[model samples]
Structure formats: C-alpha cells, structure tokens
Target: MSTVSHALTDSATMLRRNLKRMVRYPSMTLQLIGMPIVFLLLFVYVFGGTLGAGLGGVSGGRAEYVNYVTPAIILMTITAAVQGTTISIAMDMTEGIVDRFRTMAIARVSVLTGHVIGSLIQTMLSIAAVIGVALLIGFRPSAGPGDWLALIGVLVMMAFAFIWLSVAFGLASKTVESSSNVGMPLLLLPFLGSGFVPTDSMPTVLRWFAEYQPFTPLIETLRGLLMGTPVGNNAVIAVGWCVVIALGGYLWSKKLFNRESTR
Candidate 1:
C-alpha cells in the first residue's frame, strides 16, 4: 500500500481501539459530560436569577441567564472532554501500550492521531449533550440554521485544538495522575473569562485579564453566534487562537512522543 494509505489504515485501527476502550471504560466519559451539566443546572437554577439580572440590557431571570451562560458551558464541555484525552493518552504511555506500538511497523503519527480523533468525537458528543440539556432548561438561542452551522464549525475547530493540546499534556506527564491534573486549567479558564457574567462587571484588573484571555474571545464569538450579539472581530481572533494552539500542540506532542520512543 501507499504511504498515505498505510497511515490512514493505521490511524483507523488506532481510533477503533481507543473507541473500544472508551466503551468498556465508560465512567470517565460520563463524568466529563456530567460535570458541565451539573454546572449548567447549578448556575441556571441557583445563581441565574441574580446573574441574569445583572446583564446590562437583558431582562432579569433564570431563563435569560441560560442563554448567556450556555455558550460558556459549551466551551467548558470541550475543555472538560480533553481531560479524558489526557488521561487516555497517559494510560497508553504509562501502561506500555505505546511501547508495544513502537515495536510494530505502523505510521508513527497514528498513535497520537487516534487519541486526538477519538477525543474530538467524545468532546463533540459531550457538547451535544450539554446543548441538549441547555435547551431543556430554557436556553433558547436566536441563531438561524446558518448560524447554527457556523456554531458547529467553531466548536469543532475549538475541540480539535484543545484535544491536540491535551495529547501534548498527556505525553508530557510521567504519570496518569499528573496528566489529569495538568488539564485542570482548561476547565477553570472558562470561569475566569466571560463565562458566568459580563466582563464589564468584573473589577478592573480582572476585567482586563478576562477581556484579553483566549477563552474570552472564544466565548464571545459563541455568544455572538447564538445570541445574535455583535461578533466584531472575535470570530477571526478565535480562529487564529485555535490555529496557533493546534499547531503548537501538534509539534510539542510529536517531539515528546519521538523523544520518548527513542529512550
């Protein structure tokens, strides 16, 4: 077979292996999906009234808050899903699975690509679940069909970028536990951004940080798509960040994987 064909075949096999592992060990995936849903329910039912009331131009209610917060929650879902990728990659590393693969004749990149693709699939599913729950809880988006399609594209791009970063994290960690810990920032970043409330309401320093952070643009772009708020240049900025992150992560992961394989 040709080189590209061999690579594709190996990658498909590796993806199937990861998917089967996910099916057999489903708890982690479930937890990844559940955490965001809990946050959704908690914020919408618990703090939504006060928070929604605080928005500048929106009516004050839980229903209104759901619309604003759902985008953040969706972003969080992707972040949380990558945590599983880290764990899975770490497991393969620490358990000598990658070592076994190294001795075989297959595309070297397929090992990492399998984890990336599988995690992306899992992340998208988690996003879908979160959005479903958001809708059930009165999170109504104003997006038309075209807007919804754009939203999906933005989300896929975001997930792809983060999953690669997680792969790098997993490769960097020496232990599965450390791999899990390293990705915690991904989960907390949404909260530090414009996730729960308007950035303008934050104190000056924090507001500046929130405004400038990567998550803020991604969240704002999502909000603009779903709520019809002005997107401005947020879409371009968000895409730029995704590209940088994905490229950096891919390079780092490849370097780490090759270094380890040689050792």
Candidate 2:
C-alpha cells in the first residue's frame, strides 16, 4: 500500500483502540461530559434570571439568559472534552503504551492522529448533548438550517483546534496531574471573554482584554451564528485563531513526540 494510505489505515486502527479505551473506562468520559452539563444547569437555573435582566431586561430573564449562555456552555463542552484528551495521552505516555508504539513499525503519526480524531468525536457528541439540554431548558436559538450548519462547522473547527493543543500539552507534561492542570486556563477563557456576560459590563481594562482575546471572537461568532446576531468579521477572526492554534499545537506536539522520551 502507499505511504499515505498506510498512515490512514494505521490511524484508523489507533482511533478504534482509543475508542475502546473510552468504553472500557466510562468514568472519565462521564465526568468530562457531566461537568459542562452541571455548569449549564447551574448558570441557567441559579444565575440566569439576574444575568438575563442585564441584557435589556427581557421579560423572561432566565429564558433569555439561557439563549445567551448556551453558546458559551457549548464552548465549555469542547474545552471539557479536550481536557480528557490531555489526561488520556498523559496516561498513555506514563503507562508505557506510547513507548511500545514507538518501537513498533506502525505509522508514527497515527498515534497522535488517533487521539485527535477520537477526542474530536467525543467532544462533538458532548457538544450535541449539551445543546440538547440547552434546548430542553428553554434556550431558543434563532438560527435556521443553514445557520445551524454553520454553527456546527464553527464548533468542529474550534474543537479541532483545542484538541490539538491539548494533545501538545499531554505530550509535554511528565505526569497526568500536570496535564490536567494545563487546560484549566482554557476553562477560564470563556468566563474572561464575552461568554457569561457582555464585555461592556466588565471594568474598562478587563473589557479591553475580553474584547481582544481569542475566545471573545469565538463566543461572538457562535452567538452570531446560533442567535442570528451580527457576525461582522468575527467569523474570519475565529477561523484565523483556530488555524494558528491548530498549527502551533501540531508543531509542538510533533516536536515533543519526536524528541521527548516516553515515561
């Protein structure tokens, strides 16, 4: 078989391996999926009314807040799932599986490829579940079919970007605990951005940071796509950010994988 074809086949096999591992250890997957749902429920039920009132004091404040925050929660879902990727990769590295793979004749890229593809599938499923819960809880989006497709596209791109970065983090970390800690800053990005509230509501310096940060454009793009808000150049900016992140992560991951000795 051709080299590229061989890599693809090996990647597929590795993907299956990771998927099986996920099935074997359901707790980690459940925990990753559950956290975002908990956050969604907590924000919508507890703080939604007050938060929504700030957004022009819509009659059903909670309902309005639900729509406003669902996009952010969706981003969180992606972030949460990729955090698992970091832990899973770290475990493989420390547990000696990666060392074994390195000595084998299989395509070298397939190992990381499998983690990226498998985690992406898990992340997308988690995103779908979160969206379902959001809909059930009165989060109404105004997007039509095309808009929904666009939103999904945006999400996939964002998830892909984050997962690659997480893989890099995993490869860099010497322990599972450190891998887990690396993505905590990512979890905070949405909160610091325009995810939970309008950047205008934040202090002057804070608002400036929120406005220019990568997550702000991502959140704004999601809001525009899902809620029919003005998209403007947020889509372009979001895609640019994703590309830069994905490229950086891929390069860093390759460097670490090639140079770092497996624990």
Top candidate by TM-score: 1
Question: Model 1 TM-score?
Answer: 0.98
lDDT tens digits, residue span 1-263, model 2? 99999999999999999999999999988999999999999999999888988887455589889999998999998999999999999999999898888888899999999999999999999998899989998988889999999998899999999999999999988899999899998999999999999999999999999999999999999999998879999999999999999999999998999886543
lDDT of each: 0.92, 0.92
Off by over 4 Å in 1: 56-58
Measured over all alpha carbons after superposition, the RMSD of each candidate to the real structure, in angstroms, is 0.9, 1.3
lDDT tens digits, residue span 16-130, model 1: 9989988999999999999999999999999998888777455668978999999999999999999999998999999998899988999998998888899989999999999
User: How big is the positional error of residue 121 in model 1, measured in Å on the Cα after superposition?
Assistant: 0.7
* Model 2, position 235: C-alpha lDDT score: 94
Per-candidate TM-scores read 0.98, 0.97
Worst 10 residues of 2 by lDDT: 55-64
The number of residue pairs in model 2 that clash at the backbone is 0
Q: What are the runs in model 2 whose C-alpha is more than 4 Å off?
A: 261-263
Q: Relative to the unseen true structure, what is the C-alpha lDDT of residue 109 in candidate 1, on a scale of 0 to 100? A: 86
